[model samples]
Target: MGSNALINKHIDLKNKKILIYTGNSFGLNARRIMPSRPKTADGILRYAKYNIVGLVDSTCSEKNVSQVLPDLNPPNSPCDLKQAGKKIPIFKTIKDAKEKTSANVLIIGIAPKGGKMPKNFIDDLVWALENNFDLVSGMHTPLSLYPKIFKAAKQNSRKIWETRISPTELPIASCQAYKIKKPIVLTIGTDAAVGKLTTTYKLAKMANKKYNTCIIPTGQTSIMIEGWGISVDKCEGDFMAGAVEKMILEKEKEENPDIYFIEGQGSLSHPAFSTTAIALIHGACPTHLVLVHRPLRKRITGCLLLPVPDIKKVIELAEKTVIPSFLNTKVVAISLNTSGMTDQEAKKIIDEIKNKTGLPTTDQIRFPKDWTNLFMGTLEHANIRT
Candidate 1:
């Protein structure tokens, strides 16, 4: 008896390479049937999401078709399911459909298999094409999702041409397949206007001097991260979990270094910035923290508060009042995010943080003439690499 396939009626897949496989289409009551593979794009094609029948069984009536159809999913943002009820397309033999409709892209969704695809399926498909079908293609349905079907595309004389499709070299096909294992160096920074990104960048640069540095969210945004000297291939701050996980994975794959120093994004109190605190809690979350502060503080009333009033009080507030309660860290390192803060003001904050926390204070990176070069452009001691 003949049967039909149900698929999205839109999106054309005529005269194009098509691959249909088995899976969600598999009916417990039905036997596993192999779908046809076509070479080159031809014209109209029809397919069933079920048993991979060599020559589809089209005798099955519409009532019989409904019994084997897969139900629809509750639509999300992109797949507008609310307005239009889902259309589960049904087709008899793939060849019959090729003679009927115009579909160029066939992304089939199927079930699981133990190992190899059944034999003679390729030859049977080639013969079908002789009857006027296009590239006997495989349906890349959900069954082949991720690593399962990543290597599904088999090599036959026809597929060998592929018009020259090249493979990419990234390791993370699935999170489990990622290839990094050592601690990765991280860096973060913000813009000079608020000084959050600026302070973070300076710290990242300093940390790079001693360790194999790694940059996060890879780009020239005022907010940036760097490792050793090379910037990361990519970076993003908006998605905290994704950013942290990516950095962790990236670092785990590289060579283990003495340490990883991650720069923060913004001022802890500033609505837009909490960079230092963020890196400490998320990216690097170091045992130590280099709190970059400026003498000039903008009050709610828009006034500039100077000398930070009393350095001792600020120190006491940071250690006893902060850290253990806020960041929950021992407050091991202190660094200045140099600002219009006079040298004396800078020294005061540094000394206060040190005396109170008993942590060492680090230097700051001032804005150089060409800030662009400080970012996108590469930087080296010139003599060291040469």
Candidate 2:
């Protein structure tokens, strides 16, 4: 338990210096086309409380992380642009990374398509474990299951943190979340990987200033960022909702925050991940929902022929599907992922969506002030006391 040791406890990053293994997915093109693949690395680089010493990507070796992914240094970045450019170096391999920087932990930073560890990654993983560095991964394929990797870890006294493992004992969902009195805001998406986590995390950060806010991470990327969460996708179909409920109840007892922002997974309209979305809705029993959409994306991420429906229809689908079975969960706000659009284009679409849906809409990353005000305004309008 390297990173997973922080589960249900406060995170301690004093001694950990991370080296992110991004394989070949550490470039601007990957950020645009396959954002989800390098999401763990990007999230850690942007939001990790711990120190990220370097990155291991042969394709982008000798270049800094900021140079490879310039947009990572947003206006609100923790590190200044100039400092980040010189601080986090990228190396060609784990050995080079370790020799160059004091990174005692190696993180598998890509979530491949099928969740299986790529064959080419085995050698590097083994090398890292054999050395002094511990291993941390959010991939569905558990590194502990591999005999060679497990043996190397045991022999070297290194830890293997598999972030995607579900809890051993999970109670089946009995609509227990409905009993909680505090507002539970769930971020639902129009399609998979459409800024749901980013929206939830940013909103929680803003809300924490005025209210006691907690983020219930439902996916691996959020778990890596937040340090305590259950990856519901790794759970059995029947236990997915149960796992979510367990985390909510546990966090409620521990922190008792005024607001809990549950990071969403998948989409109700996407055939591949519809079940996870439905399970999250029924499990969290959210009082308010924030619908996240990528305005320019015509089709679902992996589906070529499946066209994304209109924003109005997506809102209608979410409300209709969740209201009848559970609490009166309304889609209170709209969070647009305006990644590839210019500011003018993003603003135009934001206004159009706001007019159409009659909801507070903005890109949280591009316009932090507007999003903060809009989110707080939406909460006040909904009578959710901050």
Candidate 3:
């Protein structure tokens, strides 16, 4: 499915004014910034349909958000594909931002490890609620958990949106997603920020032109863009698998697409998100796996002790240790993110990966047709109608 199909779901964010709360971690400063880890505020600023008035971050106050994170889409502006990003006003506090921009909603923009609320956070949340702004958070720490914030929101008639919480009525995993007679590709990565979501999104949009395909977003940013998805990483460990199963099963029944491209979360070897990865692999039970990686990245993000394993090793690791043991999952293709590499370097790296793993490979951003053609060939060989 595409954005047009999702927009009809009536998300109602078009006219809503929202202020993103990034706190002190809004820039590229190493001490406060986490470039590899996903930023909630960046996602909202990029994907949300709401009128994002400003960003609240005391550390970068008075500067524009684009000045800090040049990678993100410019706040409410159009630019060429390779053009410089635009800027959004930065404020020191949510109250100040609300007053300055007339924003009626406060969105938590920081996505810390474990999704825990920052130690010094409740005061600002309560302040926003008391001031009558509804709350939206992708954090695992729900606002309802804080008595003061919860009480204030109730008293002020404000709604709290917890994006990470899985639906209570999710079905238990029966592994039925794998039983459907269709191609299902899950994008797994060697580490965080390695382009799993981007690869999956591209595949969905491109593949659907010739075949019935739908992308299942499994992260907060992707969910925001797709307009519907459960953040599987934030779900309780025991229920994560079931949550994924339910999502895929429902989409299968509802859309009945010829193929499914499920977005992946963190790396299976990364300590912070391994559990979620395991749940995703078992839950989705995909027939083919597309491994995404940055060929030049040397280590697992946020961990100095763990080195990134070789691409072939990772493909072997997933097949031997995780997927093929239960289902017929193969690393059919590789999606390389060559953001900082030159054309020659990227081509050389792609050739190296293809030779090493004996898998079709492409830099999805630079040469989207490469991956799309690979998927088409796979479908044709499998005798699956496009």
The TM-score values for the models, in the order shown, are 0.33, 0.91, 0.80
How well does model 2 score by local distance difference test?
0.80
lDDT of each: 0.32, 0.80, 0.73
Model 2, 101-205: lDDT tens per residue?
868888888877867887788888888877877787787877876777766776776777778888888889877888887788999999988888778878887
lDDT of 1: 0.32
Candidate number with the higher lDDT (2 or 3): 2
Cα deviation of 208, candidate 2, in Å: 1.1
Deviation in Å, model 1, residue 225 alpha carbon: 7.8
Per residue, candidate 3 scores C-alpha lDDT tens digits across 210-293 of 888887878776665556788887667777888888888888889888788888888887988888888888888777888999
Worst 10 contiguous positions by lDDT, candidate 2: 3-12
> Residue by residue across 1-386, what tens digits does model 1's lDDT show?
01221111122222243333222233323322321111000001111112121213333333222233321222211112221123334455555545544332233222122123334234434433334332322222211222212223221112111111111222221222122322222322221123333334444444455556543432122110111121111223333423444455555467444334443443334333344334234433333333444434434112234223343343343344232243343333344454446667666765675576564553334322223242212222211100
Best by TM-score: 2
